[model samples]
Target chain A: MERCGLYLGCNIPLKAPDIEQSMRKVFPALGIEIVDLDGFSCCPAWGTAPSFDIDTWLVVAGRNIAIAEMKGVDLMTGCNSCFGVLSEAKHMIEEHPEKKAMVQEKLAKINKTYEGKTKVYHIAHILYKEIGLEKIRKSMKYKLDGFKIAIQPGCHILWPTKVMEVTEKNPFYPTMLKELCEALGAEAPYYSRLEYCCGMGALRSTDQEKSFLLVKEKLLSMKEEIDPDMIVTTCSSCYLQLDGAQKILKERGEIDFTIPVLYYTQLLALCMGFDAKEVASISEIPREEIIEKIQSEERAQ
Target chain B: MQVETVNLTQKDRKAVLAQMIEKGGGNLTKCIQCGACASVCPVAITGLPLYCKRLFRFLQTGHLEEILDDASSWACVACNRCTEICPRGVDPFHVVFAFRRIQAQELAIPASATTSLMNFYTTGHAVYGDASELRQKVGLDPVPPSTLKYPEALKELQTLLDESPMAELGLF
Candidate 1:
């Protein structure tokens, strides 16, 4: 089993470490060895690059990819922003030879050169392509047993259709994660806003009040149709928006609905028999009931 | 003292503006003034004139100063919802980012948020820098290492920062 570096990016390792842990556990079972790409920072999202300084964004992202190339493995990221940024940079470098030359020239100063050989894959792609939905089905230890989930595909992950390759109109395009949950015995509820953004993009960073209101509207819409036990997502930023923004809204005398947000890995961890505390730690949502449920199971055992 | 307007040359402004258009995924020059982007913009609807069309107009007119100074620019939530709905795929999110970069260069970010961002940049983590310190205080594991040291790379970045007129505006 060859190894691949997992580019945890800025958010998950800091704000959602459980996602990293769960991913580590699940990926190995799927035949991929997970390694860390040390020394990578924010990818800056959209903030680091000025109009004239896109070379810097390309160089930095290229350098991170170069680190994984050095390790002799493709990069796997759970963060949608990281995937989008790194993947886009890689595509740009490969497609434009002149741009690649300029980026390499700048990178030479840092002793980093991106040859554009490595591929960037989101965790979902790995689960679907490498792990195979059938293999995941066989590995299931516990079933979700009717867990209704709304798949909130972050904008960076499934949008612009040109990148990400995940289909928007077709419900089946993003069905790997949903199928993975089903394999473990959870029910994935399909909704119109299933492919919506959680409002965590540049908008959220710049205008938070407006961002929160927008997020509240999306969450309310999701709640209306699915009333899901939880909204599962692969993007940490979306998790923050759906989970943290909801709490922020409630504190501000907004709606009072408590919906726990879980990373797909955490849900997989639950089915794999990890304690809810361990799994829930990755979740932005509070973990009392989940912890209690796991505790009761422990007591029964 | 003679007050020269000190208008930035078209060449200099175009150099900076090109990056904004590319990153923003919008043709600042192509906006037809239909105001569709503005009409559907969640931020604009919330009473901020930071609509995509207006943002494009500001960038097109080289009114960087006005756009950067305006609070409406910061009101863009980067949700990219506007971009999705834009008949023209005019990404307001990217335009907002371009403004943020200007804010960083001008050292014009709100004082409170600047302090928080500075803490994260210096300490490597947002709330606190040292994982051990965070653990000692909060009884949690040390924060994972997301930042890697490339002295050579950072040195190169430092040069880029120094040359930038907006370098003085950066918190770090």
Candidate 2:
């Protein structure tokens, strides 16, 4: 069995553990053993340490990455921000010796050292690249044959490809997530604003109204273009924004429609026949209707 | 809407540019104000005036103090779209982050940002909540296998943070 450290960043384990539940159910079933990366800290998320200083961000990220190194396995996370920070930290270490020395100086006090040994991966990237679409297709108990999913690969996974270990041929026109959805037997299509930010991180933290304007625009574009049955994304932050923002938009009369949002792993867990209550039940926007739709459609088939 | 004009000579453009490059925006000197970054920037698309392109121009011209308190830098999502599309390899995301570091040093941060930062220092999680109930509801351990479950590791992280440059801010 292939093994990797599971670095559950802040959001997945705290605010949105359903995404955690989904990954817990999905990966083991798909043949990857998730080794718990105990004592790992934040990705230091973009808004926090990264906002303060670059070396500080690198040190925090280095500590988390060092934990995975101690476990002797590559690190994997369901959050794009974690993936971004960890990947960028590793990139900085490999690209700059001085930065590595700075981080090492701090890490040594905690009995840790990031020798640039551990590789970090996004869950979606692992599923698409390593798990292979054929393995995914064969593992499903219920295929999304009749559903349309709007794919949000999230910004961290796509951009500054030079710093990333696994990336698309053309990130601006990424098709990996769509193809991953297709492998699950769903129709994941293109939209004009597909590459746009979901306005979740620092933007949302700075001003909710301005942030919603971006979400509202993305939602409008998704609604008009793909009219997807749900929005599937790789990042937990995107999952939170796309899922949680709809109700607020509706209440504010900014958008009349609501679309279900799922982290790709959650949808995969559902397709793998995990119970809905355990893996897919938690969301701000109700997913009961879509869950029923998936099951009812599966029964009819 | 009032348009604020800058007297470039009054601003310390050289100091701002040097600080930006020293912090993390080494590519700041490479930006050509081509607006390619703004063409896809969420900060610009969402109508914030000081998106990457304009911020780069401001920093290049030593207008740092004028925009230090501006919330526009805080609004950057770190999407890196500007970094990807930049023709001159400006890496606009780092430039924005560099500017954010400057703001942070000046204690110009928003309350919510500080809250999350303090949360990160204490709990090893930036955006934390009591998810014990949620975790159990989803059929998992009440506490995740993280720093939350290991006090010693949390202390170790706190120690590291205490020794890093972040400690200078005294936010924790």
Candidate 3:
């Protein structure tokens, strides 16, 4: 795709604008034009429309897809939930004529129709497939050769593979994010608990204490094995959860050490020469140490 | 071992089953009480007692009330790992979601989730956390071309939610 529409789901706009800002810089620098998808709404989020009403879920998510379909460009998003919900709805409406008619009737109330011609692309897939890692490596103004990066591709990015536009080689053991990190000259080694959820979303909202169980385990696993300098996630929710939880875990004396957590685009933008504050700032956990590490790499280079 | 006298006929288990099946939980009865979904469940692994097979059993025996007040069902993150792995193609995730839709009606949901849904209903975003100033710091448009920036579009979304059964139930 020469140019794809950018679908900024709620979180990236409200809680994590840095991800949006980072993508704006990174995508353009990589020579892929990102069109602004005006008048788009929420993916309606999994917790919202999806849980209560199926029609609301389909119509709201379909409307978001309709925006891009009208533009005649595949919609792309950095948020995994958006990728999952929107893509899954697109899959259902396209497969089931009844569902498509149902959703179309709802859309027609608002004077719209879903053609289902537009594909949904997650940033990880877009970066891996459309924008090749080789191109990213060559475009890099900085390298993470010495850095040990722990990648969180997030749960939605992998599961319900039917709706996903790009399929991973092995969903059980996904290497897409790790490969993307390695392409940036970083070490993204395999860990046993890599495929596990970050314990964010509905789980965290209902039971915060229990939610930390997964984060703690994953962190300890990473600490025991990779001892990564930073944790990078492709999902905004994972980015928020991991980054926020680590600091609180450290503060409550439940864990030791602080690892700077960033959305993948934040790191990519930094390597492509975007300012650290613009892309990687607004972090709940401090970026001082990681920024120092990246600066040192630049100096060494 | 205590001998448990199981009587599913006393309670309206069939009625519950009918509702579930109507809402795409038809495969729920198709559950052979397989423990695979439970074993692979991300929440169950975290000690939440949210097993897919067990959940179906609860509904089978009209035990949803036991789990209603608790946060057990609400904690489901909907990763669908079980759906992808289920040998019966039960799509345990859909079954779980069907129950959640019911729970959303009868039980009090988590405040954060409710707040998010309300925000989505009004503003077309699950989050209203201020990042416009942050966007300004990063030299981008403050509101990012969403319903937050467009009132007309938000009206369209609000109309969808207003007509939803959740609205008729007055959840918001």
Tell me each candidate's TM-score: 0.80, 0.96, 0.95
Candidate 3 residue pairs that clash = none
Candidate closer to the true structure by TM-score (higher is better), 1 or 3: 3
**Candidate 1 Cα misplacement greater than 4 A, ranges:** A50-52, A165-176, A282-284, A291-301, B1-26, B33-47, B58-66, B75-145, B148-171
lDDT of 2 by residue, B1-172 (tens): 9989855576777788888978888789998789999999888988888888898888888888888998899988887888888999888988899999989899999998889989988898888999999999999999999889999999998987887788898999
Q: Which is better, 1 or 2, measured by lDDT?
A: 2
Instruction: Give the lDDT of residue B14 in candidate 1.
Output: 78
lDDT of 2 by residue, A1-301 (tens): 2998899998999988888999988888888999998998888888888888888888889999999898899988888888888888789888999989988888898899778889888887789888999999888777788789999998899987988879899999999999999998889888998888888998898888888988898999999987999989999988899888888888888888899888888888887778988888788898898887776654432
Tens digits of per-residue lDDT for model 3 on A34-150? 988888988978888888878788889889988888888988998887888887788878888998998889998998778788888998888999999899998887788888999
The number of the candidate with the highest TM-score is 2
By lDDT, who's the top model here? 2
Query: Which candidate, 1 or 3, would have the higher DockQ against the true structure?
Result: 3
Worst 10 residues of 2 chain A by lDDT: A292-301
**Model 2 regions more than 4 Å off:** A297-301, B1-10
Writing each residue's lDDT as its tens digit, candidate 1 over A1-301 gives 3688888776776666667677877788767788877655555454444322456567667777887887778888898877877776776678789879977776676676568777888887777667777887676666566567777767566644444444445432556567766766568877765665566755576677777767787788778988888788888888878888888887877877878888887777666666554455644458667545533443332
| Native contacts recovered by model 3 | 0.83
User: Global lDDT of each model?
Assistant: 0.64, 0.87, 0.84
